[model samples]
Target: MKGWLPFAGGMLAVVLGAVWTLQGLGVLDSGSVMDGVTLWAIVGPIVAVAGVVLIVLAMRARGRR
Candidate 1:
């Protein structure tokens, strides 16, 4: 279970990263995803940062225990 944490985080990062990136890049057009760069620029990076933090935490947790 512990070992799966990073994997899950990475997977989430990949998925969300793709979505946010595509939306930011104009590949996806769903609601605010294409409303403006503001949403993607701000929210996307924030979510991505959170995903990275989770991955880092998971890695550290695994290393400790």
Candidate 2:
């Protein structure tokens, strides 16, 4: 379970990144993904950070057990 956390987070990051990219490219228009600079600037960093955090946690969990 713990080991899977990183995989889950990475998968989430991939999915979100793809969605935003597609939206930006006008291939998928679910919403205005680039309407503001905040979303454009923050989404990638947030996803990356979350994924790294999850990966670190998963690695630490493995070390404990």
Candidate 3:
């Protein structure tokens, strides 16, 4: 359904953000270029929050329907 689009995107973003955060914290150990990068520590949470906002908006839209 059209309503699922934003929710799906939000979920994807959350997953990616969590991965980035873990890598930044040197927890996941992917061994990629981003691994153990301090910048992601700040960027990851912001991205996750954006995803949360998207999810919230999707929920609100569903409520209105």
Q: Pick the candidate with the highest TM-score.
A: 3
Summarize candidate 1's per-residue lDDT along 1-65 as a digit string, tens digits: 68676769766975686678668766677876353465664566667777777777778878897
Model 2: ten consecutive residues of lowest lDDT: 33-42
What lDDT score is found at residue 63 in candidate 2? Answer: 83
Ranking by TM-score: 3, 1, 2
- The model with the greatest lDDT is 3
lDDT of 3 by residue, 43-65 (tens): 88888988998888888888887
Of the two candidates 1 and 2, the one with more favorable lDDT, higher being better, is 1
**Model 2: residues >4 Å from true position, as ranges?**
11-38
Candidate 3 stretches greater than 4 Å from native:
none
Query: Residue 10, candidate 1: how far off, in angstroms?
Result: 4.9
